[model samples]
Target: MSKLTKYLKITKGVRVLDLACGRGRHSIYLSTLGYKVTGADLSENSIAYAKKFENKNLTFMVHDMTQPTGKDFDTILNLFTSFGYFEKEEDNLNTLKSIKKDLKPGGRAVIDFMNVHFVSKGLVREEVKVVDKIEFHIKRWIKNGFLYKNIRFKIEDENYDFTETVKMITLEHFQKYATKSGLEIIDTFGNYNLDRFYEKCSERLIVIFK
Candidate 1:
């Protein structure tokens, strides 16, 4: 989140909210810079681990991004493809709405997600991995305009199946959602270092909006 440094030049204090902040790396860095940072995640384990770093200006909590937190924030960071996990498109839109609700009148938001236009061009269909004593067979595909990953794994004599899905959302989709959620995108970057975004080449879709 070093890219965020450029936007932190405010004369007074800044309050930042990090959505899907697993383990709270971004929150920690921002807090060190004197920003009042709050890291929120649905994973109990992640939040518990992040709480260790809590201080007067830094905190972590379990939260569902789709709901409103009712606290105004100066900056909101939704990094690492954390925006589209909901099964319903409307639920995903709610996440954006909640971000808008938490933002101060002139607050900014940054959402970093995978560039679907580029990823689709080089997508892998299948793979296998063995971690520890467990073997995992993974399959990937796109259906209904969404990307899906299926994992079949064996732990000792037990077999388990899991699936992950992302909407393959593009910049166009975000633009539509942002407008309805009262946000106006101010900039778009392609990488962590704040490079230009490309439709068929860039690796990341990082947008800074208000």
Candidate 2:
């Protein structure tokens, strides 16, 4: 668990939009906290799963963040390093600009991303996990400004592999993009504890902007 949800407080009646809300983890939590929430992702499977738990205040949509959004939102969340999946830096910037345009007056955003400085400093090369009779090995690294990870899983006689890559957008890069997109950076949190960011101490970057 990333624990990023602990730092959020969505006030009542606010319309919150969560981009790339995989599995609806944060969406459900925000709905329970009084915000009218919408979980949008490109994955229809995720939307289908989200529909299973729908309430009057909660809705799910199939939205590709790389494209334009028609609905305005009071608060938008791009959590868990979800911003950098775009293949290019400008593409990522465009997404932020779109978010700015879709947000209502005084609306805010919670952009949660990996701490690039820390990831660059302590690159994890290998990791292993066991899940429900499955054993998985993950190889991760930073190559050419992109974070790459390969997951190999074997459960009984079944085997699966997945490769994912993300462009590394640093704190400075995000601040510049936000400014360029007309969003003001209000505060930055280092972790779930809401501590002030330290150059080498923070594990993640959580920015609140409007």
Predicted model with the maximum lDDT: 1
Evaluate all candidate structures by whole-model CA lDDT and list the values in order.
Answer: 0.88, 0.84
Residue 52 lDDT, candidate 2, scale 0-100: 90
Q: Residue-wise lDDT of candidate 1 within 1-210, one digit each (tens)?
A: 554667544433688899999999988988887788999999999999999999998999899999988899988989999878888889878998999999999988989999998888999899989888677899999999899999998776888999999998999999999999989989999888788898889999998888
lDDT of 2 at 114: 83
Candidate 2 residue lDDT tens string, 1-210:
234444445567879898899989989988887779999998999899998988988999999886758888988898888878876778888888888888998888888888888888898799998888577899998889899999999766888899999988778888898889999898898877778876676998888888
RMSD of 2: 2.4
* Lowest lDDT block of 10, candidate 1: 3-12
The alpha-carbon lDDT assigned to residue 2 of candidate 2 equals 31
Q: Given candidate 1, what's the lDDT at residue 1?
A: 58
Clashing pairs in 2: none
